[model samples]
Target: MKMVFRWYGTGNDTVTLKQIKQIPGVEGIVWALHDVPVGDEWPMDKILAYKEEADAYGLHLEVVESVNVHEDIKLGLPSRDVYIDNYKKTIEKLATVGVKTICYNFMPVFDWIRTDLFKELPDGSTALFYEKAKVESMDPEELVRRIANDVDFTMPGWEPERLKKLSPLFEAYKQVSEEGLWRNLQYFLEAIIPVAERNGIQMAIHPDDPPWPIFGLPRIITGQDNIRRLLRLVDSPSNGVTLCSGSLGANPANDIPAMAREFAGRIPFAHIRNVRVFDNGDFIETSHRTSDGTVNIAGFVQALHETGFTGYARPDHGRHIWDEKCRPGYGLYDRALGIMYLWGVWDSMGTSRKGVAE
Candidate 1:
């Protein structure tokens, strides 16, 4: 289980590459060119620049969190072919820089929806929160304003430019049901998985952020059954999953450790984080420990160990800690602490395995 950290870029993120390398057992950064719009071919120079920067700090840029697929690809529009070709090129370019996994998603418009960015926890620590009722009833523009409150870095799924076309985009997806989205995702995989396999890059699809339909947008990658079907859709080693505990754990029905074990080999990347889910369908990000949240993170890590997983893992979205004012969930302080907590569990499990072997 090699650990990686997600670092935005040199100047773009408050967490520097230098700080990332100091995190014990973390060997690389999961990154992408955020400035590049979806469907555009990544510039070779920009890829090289990121590579060189990571090298300067004794870190490897081995995993990219995303090479975003355009809505055309997900919507199955005629223009999808052009965007896919660009995506293919981007995959090839990323492979050149030693990126082992490309973590992308197929969610239509909003990537992840949280009704509150900084909901105050009982501990007085503020974390990203989701009020299901609020999300169900709130207008798109109102939600946008809430997310954009005093933050400079753009939210991953709620890109400002795309959000500007809120009404039109919403109307466009009015006809796109869950079935349509699945078929389109299969179409996308059929087109790109061959290239990914040839290029030695694993295309790891991140599960729908909250692992459910939000704002009438159909979400397909939510549970174990969906993952099983997804692997069969492409049936290639290059086609895989970025199993996220918090994302799938949003629904208590999901048996996270079971999914980890069942889809073990197929999952090439992981986002290990915890969230405290309330009975009212609300949730807030929490520490990596199971007691701190609803997810059994230690059990998830142990399952990965048991399944012989030897892929990349990262501490997923973290709370803003130490009064660090940066990206809402991408702060370094708490995430680094999360990594250590995960490492502690992983290390103990490794020792136990070794003892049994001896």
Candidate 2:
């Protein structure tokens, strides 16, 4: 597996590319132009600038975490054609920078949800936490304000500009059911996947964070059968998934090990992280070690190795440890620690396979 790290650009992030380079086996950065609003074509100059910065650290720029889908596209509005065209242009521009995979999601309104940004842990560290009861009982506006105030750093999907208009976005989504969401998603894929194929770029959709509907919003990318059906929407090699463990692992029914093996060749990017799920339905992010969380990260990686996975993978949300005050889930220390754990796992697995071959 080719390991990558998420780096918010120069001024936006505390973890520098210099620090990222020090990690054991990280090969690239999962990045995007955060300043560039959704549905707009990215400038080629900005794309090239990112390439130069990554190359300075002897790193590759292969995967982009998100090219945020426009509300129009998700709403299935007639103006969606304009946004889809811009998306095609954006893909064309990203291809020029050697970006192999583009990761995005079709989740309406909020991209991901967490009840607490810095939920304290037994080890004196803190991590992102999700409380199911709290979510079900809270108002969407109040929840947004709480999250906005949770951390000083920017919460990626909860951009204030988007959250400010929560009422209308929810209203727009009222008419779109789970089946409607699937049809709109199909419409989006049919328009853009061909352009992605032509440019040698793979469009990998991230599964819904928590893998369930929230606040009366429809969520379609929830589980294994849904994923199987998603692949059939476009029916091409370029149409694939990012396969995030934390997102789908919230629900106990999601067998990530089976997903890792079944979608092996199709997954161009993998977000590997662990989460501790409670019998009460809440969950918390944990270290990559299997013992620390309910998710079997070691077994999941083993499944990938067994399938001959050679795609770009990254350690997902990490705990805030060592008194390091960084982005909620994008801290440097814990993720670097997580990377070492993953390397240890993959190396041992590979060594055993090689020994068996010998």
Candidate 3:
């Protein structure tokens, strides 16, 4: 596996590209033009500037975390064709700078919901927490106000412009059933996957955060069965998934390792993180060790290794530790620790496989 790190450009992120290059085994950056308005064709000059910066640090800008799908596309509106055409242009531009995979999601309104951004852990370090009861009790607008606390940097899916139009957007999605979401996603894939194939870019759809419906929004990409149906939607190698352990692991029923094995070739980008789920439907992001969280981090890594995965992998979201003042989950400390843990498991697995081969 080729490990990558998520790096928001120069001023937008606390973690610097120079710091990212120092992380052992991290060869690439999972990035995007976060400032670019959703559905607009990315400025070629701006795209090349990011490449120049990563190149300066000897890092490959190989994977983009997201190029968000506009609500028009998700809502199956007539304007979707216009946005999709722009999306195709963005894909072609990204290929110019050697981006191999584009990781995007189809979640309506919110991308990932967390009741508390800095919930205190037993170790005194804090991490992102999800309270199911809180989700049930609060209004989504209130939740939006809470999550959009940081005015300086914008979160990928929670763009201020989108959230500001929440009422109409929510109304637009009210008629969309789970099947309708699937059809909409199929329409999107059928339109873009061929463009991605032509450019050698794998279009990887990230699973719905928490892997279930939230706030009355219908979620189609939640489990293994949906993944199976998704692969069949376009039936091309360019069409794939960015299997995220923490998102799917929130629901204990998901067999993450098995999904990794089953969708072996289709998954080009892997987001490896662990979540500690409580009996009451709450969860907290934790250390990457399998024992530290409910999600089997090592097992997921092994599944990738055994399946002959040669794609990009990244330490998804890390906890806040060591009194580090950084982005909630995208900190430098715990994520670097996660990478060491990943390398430990990955190298041992490779050694064991080689021992058998020899």
Per-residue alpha-carbon lDDT of candidate 2 for residues 152-264, written as tens digits (9 for 90 to 100): 66667888887888999999999999999899999999999999999999999999998989999999999999999999999999999989989999887999999988887
Residue range 291-328, candidate 1, lDDT tens digits: 99999999999898888778899999898777888888
Ranking by TM-score: 3, 2, 1
Q: Return the TM-score for each candidate structure.
A: 0.97, 0.97, 0.97
Write down the TM-score for model 3: 0.97
- Measured with C-alpha atoms, the lDDT of residue 198 in candidate 1 is 87
lDDT of 3: 0.90
Q: Which stretches of candidate 1 lie over 4 Å from their true place?
A: 351-358
Residue 225 of model 2: what lDDT?
A: 95
lDDT-wise, the better of 1 and 2 is: 2
Candidate 3's C-alpha runs over 4 A off are 351-358
- C-alpha lDDT of residue 33 in model 2: 89
